[model samples]
Target chain A: MKKYTYTDKKDTRSGFGAGILELGRTNPNVVALTADLAGSLKLEGFIKEFPDRFIQCGISEANMIGVSAGLTIGGKIPFATTFANFATGRVYDQIRQSVAYSGKNVKICASHAGLTLGEDGATHQILEDLGMMKMLPNMTVITPCDYNQTKAATIAIADYQGPVYLRFGRPVIPIFTPADQKFEIGKALMLNEGPDVSIFATGHLVWEAIQAGEKLAEEGIEAEIINIHTIKPLDEEAILTSVRKTRCAVSAEEHQLNGGLGDSIAQTLARNYPAPLEMIGVHDSFGESGTPAQLMQKYGLTADKIVEAAKRAMERRV
Target chain B: METQQLEQIAVQVRRDILRMVHAVNSGHPGGSLGCTDLFVALYFDVLRLKRDDQGKVIFDMDGRDEDLFFLSNGHISPVWYSVLARAGYFPVSELSTFRKIDSRLQGHPATAEHLPGIRIASGSLGQGLSAACGAALAKRLNGDDKHVYVLMGDGEQQEGQVWEAASFAPHHKLGNLTAIIDLNHQQIDGPTDLVMNNRDLGEKYRAFGWNVTDMKGNDLADVLRTLHESKNDSEVPTLILMHTEMGYGVDFMMGSHKWHGVAPNDEQLATALNQLPITISDLKDY
Candidate 1:
């Protein structure tokens, strides 16, 4: 087993900030809008560089969503940033009517996603965001793995036209993916290829999946790890191909079990090729005040939980 | 156009409204009749859009490229479709297809079905003003100073998001946008005052940092004058609280909430049409 190392542990939002700045320089149509979460969403650099393009929409998320939709009329690409909870569930109707249904090419950049946005409690931690956003038509949902990939995903969504929801996290995690890798929207990145069990992971859980794969390898269980960054257009080919070979599947994410990445994978496999599947996510409950690490452990969202789910799924793979 | 001509158009529009409502047997007629004159003034004079222009028209008055109108209170499709038809946005004969199957004139104005004139689908209320502000902002971004006009029902203002947008537009100095409230004082339930008292709408908009104005929405001359006044003031977003009577014409339904969502029967339609000056010589039963 190979050990992954990182020089520093920085929040994935820094990657978003860096990507936005790069986008500002590359594309003139790129504009940023924030709902009084400039510092939190890490859009300060882009705002500083392109103050004219950066629209401070104050605390009104609904108005901000509408304004973003309107900005598309003049052929401007707007990337609206806010917390995942406020961006999706809080302004669901606004986004549904204005952006999604209207088919506006606005990138809804969301930060502090899932239960990993710790200490905020259940009020701010939105585990149902994926379900709410993915339900809308013409919406592309992307949840990148780490700092480098988050940056790559942010930059990629700018060029991809139509409405996109780019979900990132608040905590710092492993940055294993290459810095210069081009982020494809629906393409799943296969980290480890094996045949016993397939582990599909997204967002902050990708690193955990890799760790679980390593542990399973030591136990003579060859677990394949695939990072499903795009949840909406769930890379069906990669998922089905992997599940067909492995015969068992386990999905891990720091989100609720309902309408999460696991649900998407299960639906895909059930339709194409039914396989034994286990989901490692928050089991129908709200998060409480704790650190990201503590919450992940308590809510059964860890590498060990993935290993356990994988073992259980493998046992059911007759 | 002269006031008489505008009045004549309003009568024709009222006739069309009754016919369409009667045809569907399920459409809002109260706000439709209340907003006919404002629609007439907008299509006839205020908005510099052309009927035959294939491409988007850029009105030169705003010094921006294009001027567009969005109907947020889309339940009043009869008035907008009638005005668009009368103003030649589409064929006047198309008025017959109002809300029928396979017709561009949907129950609400939807751009999804490629309805030539409409830009966005707005029937839920409290969404159009914000969308209008966005289009105005886009115009500003495109270096097109063209003005954007949106109409809303006074009762729709009760939605909290409307004020959220109302407050946002002014704070951002979106002066290119003009929102008109059809102060017909009636919603589905009853009077706006009884349902939810929106007392001092002008002051409320002013408090939200909008340049508020008042006008008789049914008076063509007043609608024109007030809309022109709204265009002149570019320092802040303007809100026209146009006071209008619910069910303006047609003596039987005038000043009442009964016609808010009910369609007219054959006798009622005939009675309503007779009140208008226009001769419906060829009233086709669909």
Candidate 2:
């Protein structure tokens, strides 16, 4: 297993905040719009620095989406920020008609995704966002793992001229990725390489996968770990190459089992190379209020769950 | 252009709407006929349109330093397509391709086919005002002093997103944006008041902090004067409640909601064409 360590912990939304600040200074045409969540979205600095460019959309997610789509006409990049639930489910038709179908250059930056939103319960927690956004024809879905990666992804999306859904979370997680890394949109990062089992993870489950890799290595089992940041426009070549070598796979995410990263990887593997696959995610249930650690453990999103799934896949391998 | 000249173009446009819908045997002709005079006044007189060096019209999608218009009530795409062609946005002969397979002129206006003069796709209701607000803000950010115009159906105001956008524009002080509500009092189901009563539209816009005005949409002179007056400097966004008949200028179809989406048949088409004669101009027939 490849050695990985973190010196600090930070929330991914703060990374987005840092990225937008830099983008505001560099790109004059970059504008920010929030659906009454500027403080929660960590957009105060961007709003303060460039007051003229920011628009407080005042709890109107659908209108905010339409406005963002319209902003692209005269060469302005708009970032519409809100929670995951309101961002995807509440205003799906607006995004579908105005942004996705129109192919507008707008960034849908969603925070407080999955159970890691912590104590907000299922009403605020959204596990179906990735699937919903991925189903759209012209949408690129992304969920960066940590602060550094989320920051890099935020800045990188500005240069990409298309509609994108950048999903992040609220909990403060370990920052393991490099600070100055160039965030590639659809490329998978190989964290650890082995031949026994391939572990594909995204968002909060990425770090847990790394921990599982270390634990499996100590037990005389080799595990290959890959971080899938971009869910749609998925790196099929990288996933197939790893699964072909390992012969079995375990997918992990802080989302539902039906339409999360596991579902995506399962479809890709089923089409190309069938293998013994185990998924670690919420199994068709709503989350309740709890601490982030407790919720993750209760929902089977911990390293132990990944390690068990990896072992199960290896055992089922022919 | 003179008011008489604009009225002549509107007559030809009404003929085109009837013929185009009759050709496809499917389209919305009521609102298209009702809003023909307003479209003629804007395209011919009000807008500082894009023109080539020889003063001929040129169609450009990007509206920087130019007045931009959006049709929120996109069911009336026949009328928009007619005025767009008559204003030299595209060849007038393209009007025959309306709603045909693989044609740029979609049943509802769309940007997918790379159609000139269409910036966003808005078949779904209540999205155009928000888009216009975004464009207006973009023009302000780019230091371009231009206006943005959008038209909506009276029944389309029932959509929740329209109210959301309505609340947003006045709060943000979008002075350069003008929204015209086609108060024809008719919709797909029935009369808009019966389907869903929009009580006192002028008062509703006034309460939402808009500069409200009323105009006769079928009258070329009133449309020309009211549209010119609405463009003056103001502290709030402008809303013009244009009162018009459902199927104006057609004696049999006027003042009724039956012709909203149903196209005219052969006999009806001939009767409608006789009502709107081909004036002394070089406009072609499809």
Q: Please list, in the order the candidates appear, how each scores on TM-score for chain B only.
A: 0.92, 0.97
Clashes of each: 3, 0
| Global fold similarity of model 2 (TM-score) | 0.97
* Residues B1-286, model 2: lDDT tens digits: 9999998999999998999999999999999999999999999999887778988876665578888898988999999999998888888888889999999999999887878888888889999999998998898889888888999999999999998899988998888899999999999899888999999999999999999999999898999898888878555899999999989999988878899999999999999999999873433554
Per-residue lDDT of A146-236 in model 2, one digit per residue for the tens?
9999999999999998999999999999999999999999999999889999999999999999999999999999899999999998999
Superposed model 1: Cα runs more than 4 Å off: A1-5, B50-64, B90-97, B100-104, B277-285
Return the lDDT, model 1, position A108: 95
A203 Cα displacement, candidate 1 (Å): 0.5
Tens-place lDDT digits, model 1, residues B1-286 = 6777777778888888888888878888988999999988887778866433564333221223557788888899888887776665667778788888899888988765665577667787778887887778778777787788989999998988888888888988888889999898888898989999999999999998989889988788889889888888676999998999988897878788888989999988887777786643334555
Candidate 1 lDDT over A1-318, as tens digits, reads 445666766778889999999999999889899999999988888888899888888888988888888777777899999999999999998888778877788899999998889998999999999999889988999999999999999999999989999999899887888899999999999988888999999989999998998899889998889999999888999999998898999999888999999999989988999999999998999898899999999999999989999999999998
DockQ of every model listed? 0.46, 0.76
TM-score of chain A of each: 0.98, 0.99
Clashing pairs in 2: none
Docking class of 2: medium
